[model samples]
Target: MKKILLAVLVLLTFIGTSCDKVDDLLTFYINQEETITIESTFPIGVVTPLSPIPVKTNSSETFKNNKTRAELVKDVSLNKLTLTIADPADENFDFLRSIEIYLSNDKGEETRIAYLDEVPKGVKAIELKSTNAKLDKYIKGETYTVKTRAAIAKPITRDVAIKAAMRFKVTADPI
Candidate 1:
């Protein structure tokens, strides 16, 4: 009887230890890096006020359900965000005085994720990197909208097309 009891305790201990190791492995696998890119066009010939420039992402319609944004992006972190101007390079590009980027959720709440003011002359790209920015607040399956407000140094009579692209580096646990 003593041997049997000892064997049972040992088995329980082994199982507990194995379970903890498995949990750790799962966590390591879930925390991974993903890149999301969005592209759009904005007319910047004139001094345009902060406008809602709709940007599309990889959100899938099939993934939409009753799941909340927090549930979808639980334990996720946004590592970096980059904005690039594809067109109007060098002399062709106008001087951008200020720019602001915002993310809108399903409930229509807009959250500012990035901002740049007094941008350097001839700069075509801007990058925002922070460890504290949590992008999980935006829904996964829903088509979250990205709004942008840009100010140019001068105004023109004709519309000058300014192409913009956004890239997001996110690390999150697998759902």
Candidate 2:
């Protein structure tokens, strides 16, 4: 009886220690979500080709807690994207056809991130949410650029305002 009890105590100790190690391995240090919005005006009487629109620049402050770009690329993920037409009710709303978003670096390289082809008429907002596990090779120091294409069924005499909102989640090792 003494031998059996001693063996059981040893097994329990080993199991407990193994579980603790697993917990340590599974621990995550930092998890956060961030949202950014970019807006531009589609000028009247001008059909803008596929070109870069104004978007927020990535600053050192973007990577808080002394995080490195390598760490951010490993941990960052795009969660949701939303596009809104601030003047959807305007007379020229139907002329606005589609918008494409791209990730661009200072080197002039670009990667298309999101595309909205057939925007529902009269709708003010559209959400392009995704369940994808990772961003498409997003690197640090990259900024977002928007390309808008419009097909005018009729001529537009006024400008239209457009906005995009991007939401993402990031997990990193705590500083």
Candidate 3:
């Protein structure tokens, strides 16, 4: 009986250590790039939803590079989201007040993934706070949508083109 208990304990220890190693090996990052355009006549001080951008995840390549598949993907979350003015060399984020970004798929369900309430002035680039929401279903799908809502603090004379960079942390099981 003593020998049987010792064998079980050893097996449990090995399983725990192996699970940890598998988790570390299967974790990786996926990045998506998008663009948002704001016309010069946009309304200020009121939250407005911008056009939803269609996204083809192309995550299969990333999964292949990481040695995992979508079926093995377990958890996904926004790690970092950055926005920068890509056009009009002299423009900055000073004209912005607040912005929120959401993620959705064909199911029509939407969830906020990143946002910023107080935007700093005189900067060409800004990083929004991540919501850290679980995003397994969204990332696993072949396509999804990025929806943005923003409220401007001031008016702009020319249309602004902003580039968005979204980085997501993906955890998957070893195949």
Model 1 TM-score relative to the real fold: 0.53
Q: For candidate 3, report its TM-score.
A: 0.87
Model 1 agreement with the true structure over 1-175: per-residue lDDT tens digits? 9999999999999999997675444331112122222223335444344445454444333223212223444433344555555543333334566666667766777776666665666555556533345565563434566666666665444443444444443333335
Ranking by lDDT: 3, 2, 1
Point out the higher-scoring one by lDDT: 2 or 3.
Answer: 3
Candidate 3 structure quality by residue, lDDT tens digits, 2-105 = 99999999999999999988787888888889999888999999999988999999888888888888998889999999999998889999989999999999
lDDT of 2 by residue, 13-115 (tens): 9999997675444332322222222224435344445445645545345554344434533455556677665553543235555555555555566655565
- Candidate 3 off by > 4 Å: 1-21
Question: Ranking by TM-score, best first?
Answer: 3, 2, 1
Q: Any idea what lDDT model 1 has? A: 0.50
lDDT, residue 55, candidate 2: 51
Candidate 3, position 102, lDDT: 96
Candidate 3, residue 121: CA error in Å? 1.0
